[model samples]
Target: MTSRVNPQQPSGTAPVVPAHRVVVLLFEGLQLMDVTGPLDVYTAANEYGAHYVTSTVSPDGGPVTTTAGLRLVPDLSLDEVDFPVDTLVIPGRPDWWAAVADTALVAGITRLADRARTVASVCAGAFPLAATGLLDGRRAATHWRLADDLAARYPKVEVDSDAIFVRDGRFITSAGISAGIDLTLSLVESDLGPDIARKAAKFLVVFMARPGGQSQFSVRQSPRHPAHSVLRQVLDQVAADPAADHGLPALAARAGVSSRHLTRLFRTETGGTAAQYVERIRVEAAQALLEAGDDALDTVARRSGFGSEETLRRAFRRRLGVSPGIYRDRFRTTRPHGTRED
Candidate 1:
């Protein structure tokens, strides 16, 4: 009998690709969750049968202390790390400002990135990644509080303060703390397919896709005060009673100016229209109500001046990227999570 040619053993063919290599870069004073959160997501994917080879590395081939006070020994140091890593994840340090200023570490990162197929930053890790010049001219997201500073420092990088995470080219940057998981899940989806990612998300008890942009947090409490006293008065009036009418005509009349002039003033002073400001005020009111109480959706809508549930839903979708019910579910303070009174 003729010798059989093994289809699996095609001679002269290139070797098959191995399991993906994921290297998480650890540093002194790094946020513990920033390293563990994304790593857990990847490791959980492996638990579901996806093949991912994960390891940790640091500047020195030794143990490093995290912000949480736990000392972690890395698998290797930057010197021992293999070249052409499949995924290079840099977790955030508490003092990213100082991390960027560490010339030796920044040089090592640039060298590592030069060989890595994909590069990522968790939260303020973007600071060091940005320092490497890879994020230059790329759209990136950091913790919303520090986004402005990042933009100010690296004028070449476009900082998106509102995104939960951003991917530009081979660089993935995420907003503060929990957003790293979101970014990693997206990567898992891209690498292993959506089914695996969905299962992993379920296993982790996280949303397959979280409902909204980065939570507004402190930004909503302080909007810019208009230079014009009338605009300030209009803002105050709207805040005083979100249920009340504060349309352009009403505002224009109250300001003792023509509607067109009022519109121009609003654009100049607030950088948006009168209608936009009112909608934001209403959304803020709705957010406050949802967070504080267990009111009916319709009641909340009407009280927030949305007039109807559909309008409230639309407004929430437009501004928060989530439905009213979903927002309430995520933010409700009236009851402890996963507890329903019998």
Candidate 2:
């Protein structure tokens, strides 16, 4: 026989709920920030109300030392976990590929993920999840530096290196260290509500929501290989003065090369035309100006070498999938009252 609870006369009543169980899988030589960042978000949420209960677990339930030489004791062993997990988090190690070779650990992760409502990984932690075959046929994100490597190693997974975090079905993966905080804040927003998530973000002193994707933070350094010195010099100059005339003839004149040679050499050495590279640099500069202050679009356009607000808008939309105004609205940092703009 099945028992049914009464549903009548429940107006203005708050329903009692048990806290969501969050389990973090700990391992030796993992990054410390990956564990602490997301955990701090959950802990902060507790201040608002009892929304989540967090626990750390290891394969043997023993003390594990981090890559930075800090030791952490797990709250439980893998075998000791008896409750269903509402969320499962895995933090990454520097030598993450080596961690993927542990068959027993992979089996344990698969088992837990099977019972978890949601599974997440931070940075290189995606390695272990991909190793479990759970991430196969799914979209995922990881540290931008390791994105190509992740794709090469796990051809079955669709790796989005540009995304800060990606949620595919029950799985979620985040890019590098601090991105873990953003990913967890999003999770809090999903599980609780945006109001709680906004409060948590305000407490952390971060944007209630960051704009753009990992592309904004990606390194735009020139290639290290020695190929075309002229092209490299031209690229550096463009970066230094995006507002300067960087037409092919001007760049070629500055680099002491013919326009034909410059264009060919840039394509051969950088895998993109000189014009494309200059446009990307300009867009990046514009993104920075937008994030740092409340500048008018026209001012930002002139400073970023776009020369006009309409050009900046088109470039932003073509590259970043968002408008300049929207990007600024989401990413602009709040300035203190007494602080002066330099």
Candidate 3:
């Protein structure tokens, strides 16, 4: 059998050939889901004649035990590898912050950063990347719980907690475990085109193609009581008509409560002011329209309560790291009979 060319193996090249070199990093207490999620997806790409390569690496050339007691053997030591890597990925560990404080792990990551075309992390693996100073002043994302810490520790970096994954040039970071699959499939798509990525998504039975900006947990509120169903109903109403300039006064009237009491109640229950909650709902609504691929950008923005495309773009950049147009192109669904893929 004649082997085909693997384009993704060479760093920074347009992918015409299949992926040639992909490396994954493993460390002590790594999350089993993070390591295996990308690994499984990439392995499928290889089966389809993607001509990919994968290897595990460790700082000391030994088996690294995971948080779940699964030990992974590294193919190469931190000092022994010489292959040109197109994509270098690091899996998240349970106590990633503690591990990152270790100089050896940080050095291993920094060395890999020097050679890889694209350097990426899953969840807390971002801690090491942040420590490496590769993400300074760059747009990135991580698990929501760590967002504040990542921001405070790496004061130079801008962290968006809502995104499933974020790409800052060649540096990529993903949220918790499952999002790693989303990010990896996206990488395949970016390298080979949407067709291959879609195929991989289908093969994995995962929704690799999704629209909308990353929805922030800060925007979602948990109800304090089953009796607070009234408040939930009001939220639903606001979500349905975000473009309407409904205010605390109007919302309180609808909920049959005084505006002052309603404000205090919302803050107590959701940990956010009513206005902040409304903004989150509106932004999320706008994201849905943009991802749907049915309406014009301006129309989507208007309906989603953004008022204008420019407003939507600014919010998207501030929150999602990429522009709205790019986000739509990446995650928007094309109508099978009528829309074009490219």
Report every candidate's CA lDDT: 0.79, 0.81, 0.75
lDDT of 2 by residue, 211-303 (tens): 325362633663444366787688789889999999999999998989999989877887788888888899989978988877789999999
Q: Positional deviation of 166 in candidate 2, in angstroms?
A: 3.9
Tens-digit lDDT string for candidate 1 (160-275): 88788888889988988898888888788788776666666776888654433644353335566678887777777887898987888987887788999888888888778889
Q: Which residue ranges in model 1 land beyond 4 Å of their true spot? A: 1-18, 211-219, 222-247, 250-265, 277-342
How does model 2 score by TM-score?
Answer: 0.79
**lDDT measured at residue 78 in model 3 versus the true structure, 0 to 100:** 82
Error of 2 at 196 (Å): 3.9
Of 1 and 3, the candidate ranking higher by TM-score: 3
Question: Candidate order by TM-score, highest to lowest?
Answer: 2, 3, 1
Worst 10 residues of 2 by lDDT: 1-10
